[model samples]
Target: MGIVDSKGHLYLKEDPEVWIKNNPASRLALVTSFRLNLENGVEEIAESIGELTHLIHLVFRWCRSLKRVPNAITRLHKLEHLLFHSCSRLEELPANIGNLVSLTHLQLSHCEDIKFLPNSIVNLSKLTSLTLCHCVSLVELPANIGQLASLTHLKLSSCRNIKSLLMSVANLPNLTSLSLSSLSLSEIPYNLGDLKKSLTRLDLSYCNNIEFLPNNIANLSNLTSLSLICCNSLIELPSNLGQLKSLSYLELYYCNKIKSLPDSIKDLCSLDTLIINCCDSLTHLPINLNVLHLKLLNFCPRFLPNGLINLKYLRVNICSCSDESFVNWKDPYSLQHLAISSCFSHCNYILKVPASLNQFVNLQVLSLHYKKRFVELPANLVGLAHLCLLDIQHSSISCLPWSITKLRRLRHLMLPKDFRLETLSYELNISVIISVNERHVRKTWEELKTEIGQLPIPFGGEITNDAAQNPSIMSHPGYLWLKENPSQWIINNRNLLKLVRFLDLEYVELTDSIMQFSELTHLCLDIAADICLPDNYFVTFTRLTHLSLHFFSVGKHKSITHSLSKLSNLQTLHLHMHHSVLLANFNMPVSLKYLSLSYCNNMRPLYDSLEKLTNLKTLDLYSCV
Candidate 1:
């Protein structure tokens, strides 16, 4: 019986014995926003909820048999947002709760039986966002919490019996985001540089007994994000930390007794993202870091900061390096995304693919992970040419270089998901091909139309249908043919197709050359048999937006779920069905925002079409039964 609307909002999830039997002056005093969730047998909350009195947003979520919180809610004097998140058997919080006075946002996170806080909550005074994250029996705080005075965001992460902090929190002065992550602090408040002019985000991540750091913390200077993730007794880091200068993100993960980095950090210069993962005794890296996104995991830095040159995203993991460690790795040349993993699992390492990687002539994403002695790949990798995404995972690279079809802006080719191709370099004119050996596993649609009429045709002569209806030869910008007779070169180069991935082939009938590309935007198909795709077969691509379908059975497909709800610029949808499939009129695409379903079965008639997606933001379910 709670649903008020018309400006005076009010929402309450049933069961507090039916809204405490209503009648709070009938219209609940025009509640100005009040939300209450009663998780099962609610334990308490009805002081007639202070008769609403135009409550300015008050939420008590997941009551979990709530236990106390009714000091008549501090008499809601125009309360400005007070939340008891999770309410895990809430234990405290109403010692006058600062007498409301228009309190400005306060959330008791997880409230694990909160232990301390009501020191009159420092008289709120327009409190500006205070969240006690995971208050695990929170102990100590409120040593006059710096008299609140418009406190600006403070979240005591994980609380963990908070060990030290209250030096009156450097007298707040509008603290700008401070989270003592997973505290049990072993040192920090030496007046914390008195919140150097309103700190701008500082999270001592998982403070594993913080080792060193108070060199006035480089006097903040408007700190812009600094997180010492997994502190691990952080060895050192205050060597004037380049005096912050509006630092822009720095995360030293798993600290590991530091070991070096303070060469004044080459004067940060507004450093833009630097994460050194698992800092295994860091070993050098401060030669002139004009950082622009750099990540190194499991550490490895005998040398590689020849003045980065405004590096643009570089990631290296599980280092073992030694081809002269990238021969002094010099001049990043504005690297555009590069990732390397398992650098070379030692043991007489023989990986070799770094001929200085052609000096990144504007590389655009190249990732090679778990290189189990990576076998091969450098046929000058087609001289970069703005390479557009090439990923080789769990590699032992088995044949792929027919000069990789001379790249020419290759659009996404990710191989090695246990890839098993024994051959296919017959001057490969690639489109999307995956052959799972075992003598062509299962290809019988007339041997897949006689192997698509013996493939191989990109840029290899042939013109006349009046030069393919010349509009300057169909908007020339050649070089994207993807093979001979590939459905007549994909219907005369349908606007130079954009991204198509087909894996585990077999019985693949290209669907009229995939509806004539028409500016296709990423499509992946993995069908291994039981076809069924004709409900207007994707209704003319329509600028398709990322779709992946992998089905082995689903035989009598129900019009492909009504043509995936008439994709209106579909945004990422992946469906994998094998055998048991009854999407029961699935119907997705409310302009989907990433939806993944695997091995779906009954799924209770797809639960009201997944509640009409409502612009779904990631909903992944596997082995759905």
Candidate 2:
């Protein structure tokens, strides 16, 4: 069962005679539970897996050409799980591997030339999770390694030249989680807290000259996650660092002479995520970091801890504090999410706007990236009517006011990235440009030549029906949706009067205003060559439910999914064509849950008709050849 194509990509081939005629000890008994992986391709199953020893997991991991492992697997004593992860040309191991004493789980991670191990593997004795991570030419072990006392999770991370990690393997008292990261070793063997009642999680990051840390590490206290990152000459913390009271994550990054911390660090009040990046001699923080109930607070500013007062997700990334020190609103009001980089990058020499920023009234999203020159906003930024999402990426913004089209509960207004608009208007404020120049500025120099210079640049960005029939904008609603989506005349004319429910003409090549939508529910037309679908093209789309047509070419519906199955509550469907244009020969409609087909390269293998849809959860077949 293999090679599935049409862009989804699947391979799976090999079949040594259907696994040697369905596992033959020469007999027949079949019911699922079968397993045999000769690790990698080719090797044609070592002369038929030595005749399938009642296989229940026999993986000759990466069996690279001939070389042993076939002492016929010591006659499989009902093998359980012997995975040789990374058989780096596996050098040795078939010393009858203790005859698979019903092996529980033994994975030789990295299996590099198998340096040594096999004191008959302590006769497995029903092994419980033993993985030699990176086995790295494995230096030494098996001093009865405490005889694996039913070990529980012992991962020796990057065990290179281990040096001497054998303190009799910590006497394995049912070990629970132990990792001596990059064991370059410099000393930690102080009876590592005697595995304090089964340690929880501890990683000695970059063990470099350890420098001291194990007075029984305050007796583990069921340690709840601790990493002394880059232990660079580690210098502090051990006045019983608050005795681990179930320490909720503590990562001391790049310990550069470790300045200070540990006024008993407020006894770990369930600390969330705290990444101390670039410790740069980390200056003081933690006067209990504003009552430390943090949910992800990444650090950089040489350690920020000034009255964080429980900062509610604020990323002031490296401060220089100058939008008058962020409007000086001190209360932080559990700030929802604010990103203030290097203090408003000279935001147009801000003269005002910090009317205490309405005390961040649970602000939703505000992004301002201004390097300087001019960006002073918020003159009653409409008192932030619960601002939805305004991203002013790098600013010098020329204009945007008409009370920003009266917020009307604004959803998303993201302009600023090359947002060079010469115009977008509703008589643009300044008191509507001084009341249209005190009434037409004395009979017009082209009537105050504004109105987006008489708008019109293809696809619904219209505005010039003699400037929307300007007898003072005869009830201008984009000049009645530009005479209701009709085209080709003056520069533009959008006369749809208010009611713009949802319209997104993606790659606007213009022309084909779908009868200019009468309260369009959702329409996104892309790469337009020519389009116009609303000659009642399927019952006036009674509140259409998302339709996106890409790479178009109209007037030839070889039967577009049987005419889009007549929209019957269409959820979301996007079709893209070109390359091998065929308006028909298709199958869709299970009331699409979300479908995407792009660049019809040659459209064949539709995954067996897209697995009968079944209210699909999402399917994207891009560049479909």
Candidate 3:
């Protein structure tokens, strides 16, 4: 069955004839939008579709057998949007499609058989957007396309047969955004500059044959963004590019042929974000460019600007540069996010933190990734009071300075996955760990039994006597039983506990102490033992939106499903369990939007449970049998 909204919008996945036969013609006249999707056997729409005079939007998606659009569709003069995607067998559009004088948007994607648009398409004077992507057979556009005076956006991607665009495109005086790619042209149309007064964004990504841009491109004074990603053959840019006074963003990724940027780039006072990554042939960067956000990967410059007062975000990766290149900043107080990483496994260079790091008072997010050379952080980090996120994963740093406890605003702390529980407990000064071995298991178990009696019963019931008596179960290396009373440091840093929002742990025993993070919105646990969660644990996390659990061994945890279903606010859930764990009766929250299950066998029993997740938009099953 299809759905009809209160505003007279109809969405149908089945044949429309079945619906029309059940409804009155008068009711159909009120429908302003109609969408038909996944009706794979549908070849043609009924000409009676023209009777819906109020129709404003029409879409046909994944109708693979559809070959043509009826000319009767043009009779709906009020139609403003027409879209067809993944209709691979679609051969052509109606020749008189322009008869819908009110059409403002049109898109056709993955329709491989489409070759050229009808010349009458120029009659759609009200059209504002036209997109034809992944139409491999499309060769040329109408020569008079500029007649669409209201057109503001045009995107033509993956149209490999389109060797060049007609010069008339420059006549679109109101066009503000233009994207072109996957073409054989070595240069853009010379007249493209004619639209300088209105063009604000230009993207030529994946245009592999383009070598150099015309100097007249500098005439686009109002342009705000320019992207040349993966344009491998491009060697140089227009020398007068700095003339674009309003330009704010520029990206040149994978353009390996470009060796250097124009010196005039320093004149771009309004530019704020610049990204030049993977440009292996690049040797140097212009000094003192006034940008607020900058990223440089795999390309190291000999020198950096002395003072970038407005810079707020900076990321440099895989660059082999001297420590001087980073500490040279004179006034870096405005920076809010900084990340530096060394990803090259064989690179011997060691990246060191700048000695003047305290100058960045406004910094909030810091991430550092290094395989082995990076060992420690500065002793005093209290200078960064506003710091909220600190990620040092994949680094050799084993311990953190005790002064880290002063970061009251620190909410997200990501450590290396292999970090030991004892080290974390000692650094945080929060827990008293208890170790149990085969010889002393009985003594420790008797003492813990009295302590467990006072605590709330855990989900999936308490540990059984037989299981507790087993030597293999009691002596598991990952287990770490803690006392109920917290250390004095935990009492003094109560605010930090309340503000923490994300935690990622491995082999850490689940205990009542975790419930203190009342504001946590994300939690990830990598469990190596057969443990049960505390009672009402998920119920207390009303704000948690993402949860991931990786179970390493199979255990008797029948309440796992009931425990997960209690999380009403969870939006994303990831479960990576051993193949032996039975997935029968597994139910997830209805609010979940993304679910990923990996390495779990016998997933057929979960089909019934998944059918109830109406809001789920993405489901990923990896290595599931």
Candidate 4:
């Protein structure tokens, strides 16, 4: 007995001669954990799995289609990990869950439909991690939940509906990490008399309506990190916080109401990191603050606190008085990282960075963003040989000077999109420009890559490496290294030819594909408004398997029919059209497994003909007009 295809396909008729029978764990146990199945279309679990009590892990994460766990699951005494994360349809946990006291990890993240936890959960004293992240539908926790004294970690991030903790959390003496973002508690209870002594990290950010911290927070003493980044209404801190000798980090950015720091703070000489931003109205720092060697400092640059003398790093986007640099450092100290984000619009100052930075020979990273009409790199920048990243983005300057070539050690040089370079290596490829996120920025850079690759702007397209030879694209770090070498374009095509396993040609304007990327397995061509598959366009791409077409051809009623019968390995097809028709009958082969057509206007005939695809297992028709 096991689950398959949204039902319990009971293997009740197994031949008696068969000695080796399959079990629940036999269903792909290679993965340690898989969560979020909200769209799997599974309506229920079959009762057959009740007999597979030996299974140690059961995860039905985000199973929005399943309203309940099979009743037979309670017999799984060997279960060690259970996760039903984001299971919005799950309204309750099996009451017999208590019978499996061997459970050590439980996660019910984003289970918005659950109203309560089974009281039996109290029996899991061996639990190590419990997460109730975003359980917005939950109203209460089982009163006995706190009985699990062995609990070491608990997170209740975004449980907005919860009004109170079960009070049992205090009993879990070994608990170390706790996050209670957006809790509804009016006040933290002082009933513990002491904070959880073993607790090391605490996050109470965004609990805005709460007025006070428990007085016992200091007694725990072992706490190392505290985050209150957006507790805007917090007016006071418990005196106990000052005595936490182990605390290393404290954050209070946007807590605007508080104006002063407690004298108890002087006891935290061991503090290495502190952030107090957006407390715009209050000013001045305690004289004893000079003893701190803070690693980072963030605040309105115009209203810098006076006593931050040994600050190691500063991120100030304020306008400094004409040619003036603040003196909050002891001739450099640990000031190795600095970011001055904004330049004054009105003042025409000396435009000199502080002279003290000369003592900071160790400065390795500097970023100046969104500057006014400033031009040219600062003279001090060229000397910092150790500097690895320099970003002067969104500046009024239009071009970088030849002095930039001296930054031999620099790895990432970021500037505004309009900035241009003249005499740089012709072999440079924009693909080397790394992006923090894979979105429009990536496409913009890729478009630039294809642009820069096609014709090295301002330089002749004479690739030393002939395209006839295939070379490994990954061996070369910088495309510029291939200059004056004939084997360059060969390497370029080798790099781009089959390198893109996932193709995202959203708005590519090529009238015809010029090259064959035989290894391209997945293609996304949404927003390709006027693109039409060329005749015999994909004939050479034998490995093309998955294709997706979406949005951008609005009201055009474009006819898009193609012969992909050669794609014998095709597995999935996804289409999203505003108005289009199959120009010709699809020559889909037998390997196709999934097909989805979305937002297709006048698509009834196309689906009616899809019945010919007998091998198709999954068909999705959504938003089709």
Cα-based TM-score, every candidate = 0.32, 0.30, 0.66, 0.57
Model 1 TM-score? 0.32
After superposition, the stretches of candidate 3 with alpha carbons farther than 4 Å from their true spots are 13-22, 38-42, 301-303, 318-325, 329-333, 344-362, 369-388, 393-398, 403-625
| Native-referenced Cα lDDT, model 1 | 0.69
By lDDT, is 3 or 4 better? 3
lDDT of each: 0.69, 0.54, 0.72, 0.58
Per-residue error for 56 in candidate 4, Å, reads: 2.6
Q: Which prediction has more favorable TM-score, 2 or 3?
A: 3
Put the candidates in lDDT order, highest first: 3, 1, 4, 2
Model 2 lDDT tens row, 23-91: 444331221123233435443334443454554454544444323456565566666666766666566
Clashing pairs in 4: 464-485, 464-486, 464-487, 465-486, 465-487, 465-488
Best by TM-score: 3
| Pairs clashing within candidate 1 | 457-483, 457-484
Q: Which stretch of 10 consecutive residues in model 3 shows the poorest summed lDDT? A: 471-480
Q: What C-alpha root-mean-square deviation, in Å, does candidate 2 show against the real structure? A: 19.0
What TM-score does structure 2 among the candidates reach?
A: 0.30
Output the worst ten-in-a-row residue range by lDDT, candidate 1: 474-483
